[model samples]
Target: MSDSHVTPPPPSPSAGRRRAGTTAALIRAQDTAIPQADRAGSGEPPTPAQAFDALHAYCAPALIRQAYLLTGRHDRARDAVVRAFRLAWQRWPEVAHDRDPAGWVRAATYDCALSPWHRLRLRDRHPDPPSDPADRALQRALLRLPPSYRRTLVLYDGVGLDLPETAAETEASTPATANRLMHAREAVAACLPELADPAALHRGLLRLGSAERSPAPGSRDIRTAGERSIRAWTRCALALTVTVAGATALTLETAPTHYLAPVSPGHAVQGLPVPGSLGPLSRDALKLSTKLRKEAGGGPERLVPQAR
Candidate 1:
């Protein structure tokens, strides 16, 4: 990996053209999040950083809220959004060209927030309940529901995504999404009878989602961290490649060049020392030779002496 800093390239012309049709006001974004100096040249498409800033500014809050509804926790919700944007910045070109950039980020956020691993954390094992009694009950109901069902309900009802869109985002068929939504609504309504009506349930979800607000991350930091993450992974891959190449070289250096025939097992040979046996004593060698001469033409046991 090179030590040189690399700037993210500008979006393609097609992506830039989308910005012409989009206005910050359309998304109800509060801040440009980009400094005046970072502004693009007149009539040119916004830079990657600028586009990311605009997207982050617009979608983060809504995604966080939706995440809170999905996970029923503030910290997890915030973390999910931050991680999603970091991933978006890492794959800036894909995200920039995506038909629904917010949806792309939203999918990533939901996956992060709903990961089963988070449930294992001591911090996340138990979260503080909302202050309002109704909100508290609603969140508990949402938490009681299964993860897939909870996600479906939140995306469909809380985020107002149509059935087909929800199904696509959740990667389930439309029928399956509808089934989960139905089950989830039934479960929530079972806990809170007053929310039996769909409109009332939607309002309940909105109240629960809006009960808490986690701060949105700065786009600049997210981009920097994304780049840093890429650099770190690149370094790790380089180090692993170098290690593998070094190991291969070492093996080649020590390996035998030609095959040697194997010694047959269980074969006996005369005058060969036993494995791990020491050399014969000097006095014993002479005595053994004399004994052998005297014992010639005798029993086989007398022809050879024990090595010891």
Candidate 2:
């Protein structure tokens, strides 16, 4: 409702380039800080710490901005990124080998930011006063979109991910992602007509980015937070596993047992008789059986039968 924490107007093109350069520099600095063995092209993947640092430096700021756009809260956005990176740290071995580890973190942030758990907390926080009418309008428009469309827009346009990358991050097919992007663009354009132009849309997003340009956490802070999160997550997982296993065992132990005794041959044959060839009986056989039954009854005499 308010832009109290909203980012300022978009920076000039040259200033945007400078900002991009600074981000790249931050990433480079973090990369170089890693142990020699963990450096790129070292024929070995970075250690968890090294990988976490690299990913956080490169992705955290953008992820925070994206999450903020999704949640409309700076604190929630930061928490989402932190939690996402924590998970990435826990599974660093797998993440380190990923072709786009930053994308993985971005996807996780998306999930965290939009989680239903945040809704109750959001209700408790006071809404900021509206700073700019345009910013407020854009925020309302984005929030009005369904989660899927909103996430697609954030990942593709806000996070600067390509269509395929966005689809992969969103776990949707490429064609579906393209359709979603088109729909999302149309929706936003409907609300903010200037976004009808592609360049204007990008510029609008750039302005949003410039408004809330917070720095990422330091490597040590990320490491500490990540380790704590991993430990808590591991404990929960283990407890859940144990609970499920115990429940399963208890159910099996307390279940009723039934053993059927073998049926006698005579009793077994009490139902329909099996056919010799497992096929339909012929008309002749049916007629013969009926005649034999009639003769065996011997109830009535037929004069025609004697002549025959």
lDDT of every model, 2 decimals: 0.79, 0.70
Q: Give all TM-scores, in the order shown.
A: 0.76, 0.62
lDDT digits (tens) for residues 1-308 of candidate 2: 12333222232232223234544664685667676755547467556676577667677877777777787777777788888887787788887777667667878888998887776774514433136677777777778788899888776666566666667878987777777777778899999997776567766765665556567667668678777877888999999999999999999998879876888665344678676666666899888767766873453465225543
For candidate 2, the lDDT comes to: 0.70
Cα deviation of 137 in candidate 2 (Å)?
1.7
Highest lDDT against the true fold, candidate: 1
Q: What is the C-alpha local distance difference test score of candidate 1?
A: 0.79
The window of 10 residues in a row where model 2 has the poorest summed lDDT is 7-16
| Model 1 TM-score, 2 decimals | 0.76
Query: Residue-wise lDDT of candidate 1 within 1-308, one digit each (tens)?
Result: 12123222222222223333445452444245555565545745567887888898888888888888887778888999999999999899999888888788989999999998996798897866889999999989998999999988877777766676777999987767777777787798899999877778878888887877767777788889889999999999999999999999999999999999998789666997667867767897988777766763643565557677
Could you tell me the lDDT of residue 83 within candidate 1? 96
Ten-residue region with minimum lDDT total, candidate 1: 6-15
The regions of model 2 sitting more than 4 angstroms off are: 1-29, 35-46, 122-130, 232-308
Shift in Å, residue 108, candidate 1:
0.4
Q: How many residue pairs clash per model?
A: 0, 3
